[model samples]
Target: MSKLQIESALEILLQSLQSNSVMSKTFFWNYLKVFCKEGFLVDLQTLSIALVEKQAVFLIDSIACLDYKAAQQLDILVLS
Candidate 1:
């Protein structure tokens, strides 16, 4: 895909994510990190694809933006 096409697709995804009800927006991102750490690449990709189908979204927390609230642990999801 061209640069513009990729940007457009990401823009659509970002807009869709903005509309979803986020239960701790970082939930899925933290889950992704843990999954990758534990070597669940295939499982994570499969489940993420399924969630994207429903427009589910996760906003990752960055260390540079750390604050009192950010210090609190985010909700982590464990998939069996």
Candidate 2:
């Protein structure tokens, strides 16, 4: 990816990390994959790598899906 794309991905990832809620591994991983492919996330593997490369405390730093607003903001995406 170009530098700009990579930067954008990083920005998106950081934003997501800060604002998006943590999802189940299966759900979050799948969502992240698409975002990465779409150039919305840089170093997509960072999620999984964070699991193994870092300690449990590190992985525990993740947010919960309940905290994610993006899903709720989209009427079609929200189930309820």
At residue 79, what lDDT does model 2 achieve? Answer: 19
What clash count goes with each model? 0, 3
Question: Candidate 1: deviation at residue 17, Å?
Answer: 0.4
Q: All models: lDDT?
A: 0.36, 0.39
lDDT of 2 by residue, 1-80 (tens): 45455444434544455555555345545655565356432333343333333322222223223223332232222212
Question: Which residues of candidate 2, in runs, are more than 4 Å off?
Answer: 20-31, 35-80
Model 2 pairs whose backbones collide? 22-63, 22-64, 22-65
- The candidate maximizing lDDT is 2
Q: How do the predictions measure up, each by TM-score?
A: 0.27, 0.32
lDDT per residue for candidate 1 within 1-80, as digits (tens), equals 23343334434445544555575345534543443344333333343343344444242133114322321222122122
Lowest lDDT 10-residue stretch of candidate 1: 70-79
